[model samples]
Target chain A: MRLLYFAWVREKTGISSEEIDLPAHIETVGDLLRWQKTRGEEFAAAFEKDRVIRAAIDQTHARHDAAIAGAREIAFFPPVTGG
Target chain B: MIRIQEGDFDLSAEIEALKDSRTDIGAIVTFTGTVRDRGSDKVIESMTLEHYPGMTEKELARIEQEAHARWPLQASLIIHRVGKLLPGDNIVLVATASAHRHAAFEAAAFLMDYLKTDAPFWKFEEGPDGAGWVDARETDGAAKARWSAKSSSKEEPAST
Candidate 1:
């Protein structure tokens, strides 16, 4: 899967896009997020407050439990307030 | 519907284009948003707009279609400029034409409201001190919320 970060997420994650091999068990947005929290201190800090964070699967906004199968892009960012 | 490049537009030309052939169209409502000189009390010299290329077009097209479905609109146009913009430069434009003044006015306002909240563009303001991203505004959310109830009762159009 291709993981993309933006705004404050990009600031903390320190990189914009990365290729990740997800475990077969990570099937939902929440599960993917939980796994991201274990990557490093930066990843942990970014996902610490998930309330303000938003995830989009393949550019479409996704709920926490949205499926991730056959997904090409998973983007994480702060709630968009941009015009 | 027409969305243009980041070039200055003549208001009369845009309005005329919508009114050309439709004799039934009785009203034309337009809104033009400009980059301000200041934001959050900071003096802004310039503002730059960045947008998600494919998604930005898709979102704006959806907003236009929604306005048309809700009102008896004859025609509408939305032109939002991207790239670097300065104070006094036009940021966005919304124009709606309808058989009645009310529909034209309502649809034009609706388009602007949706654009503010749903558009994919990001604004970065540069001032004497530095540059920073523009914050999400609460006023925009209120504007979009007004139309939500009506949309819920009526079938919402599929977004592009």
Candidate 2:
């Protein structure tokens, strides 16, 4: 699976995207956020405010409990500020 | 039509294209969002607009389709610019056309409201003081929520 970070989340994570093989336990967006924090200090800081950070599965906006099974791409970002 | 590009768009040409020789269209409403020089604290010199490559277009198209389904619109267009932009530069444009003024006006507003919250775009402001990401406004969320109620009355076709 591919993970993308945007805005402050990107800044904190220090990389825009990465390809990772998720462990069996990471099945939901919330689960992925929790597991990513344990990867490194940068990821820990990026997901510090887990609720504030938004997640998208397969480029669609998703809630914390959204399933990530078979998703090709997942993105994390702050609330959108576009107009 | 939905366009996401780094280059600025011509409002007049876009409106003309939306019209496309259709004489039945009675009203056309447009909203343009521009880069502001002043932020909450600093005088912003430039702003950088970032967006997801594939997702941005998809989201915009989805909202545009929703607007069309809700309103009796003759045509609609959305253009959003990304990358570095100076103050006063155009950031986004939404134009809606219908047989009556109310539908055009309401659909344009609806599109703008959805774009603010649902679009996969972020704004970063830079000035002499410093640079920071623009925070999402609660008011924007409120604006989008107004359309959640299934108000069939608002979707009435234009008689004029």
Best by DockQ: 2
**Residue-by-residue lDDT tens digits, candidate 2, B1-160:** 9999999999899989999999999999999999999987789999999998898998899889899999999999999999999999999999999999999999999999888888989999989999999988878877877897452221111111
Quote the lDDT for B29 in model 2. Answer: 100
Write one digit per residue (lDDT tens) for candidate 2, span A11-44: 9999999998999988899999999899799999
DockQ of 2: 0.47
What candidate 2 gets wrong by more than 4 Å, as runs, is B149-160
Interface RMSD of each: 7.2, 9.9
Compute fnat per model.
0.19, 0.63
Residue B37 error, candidate 1, Å: 0.6
Tell me the lDDT of candidate 2. Answer: 0.89
The residue pairs in collision within model 2 are none
Best by lDDT: 2
Candidate 1 residues B58-145, lDDT tens each? 6688778888889998889998888788999998888998888999998888888787766666677889999877766666666778
What TM-score does chain A of each model score against the native chain A?
0.95, 0.97
Error of 2 at A20 (Å): 0.9
Each candidate's DockQ score against the native complex?
0.28, 0.47
Residue pairs clashing, model 1: none
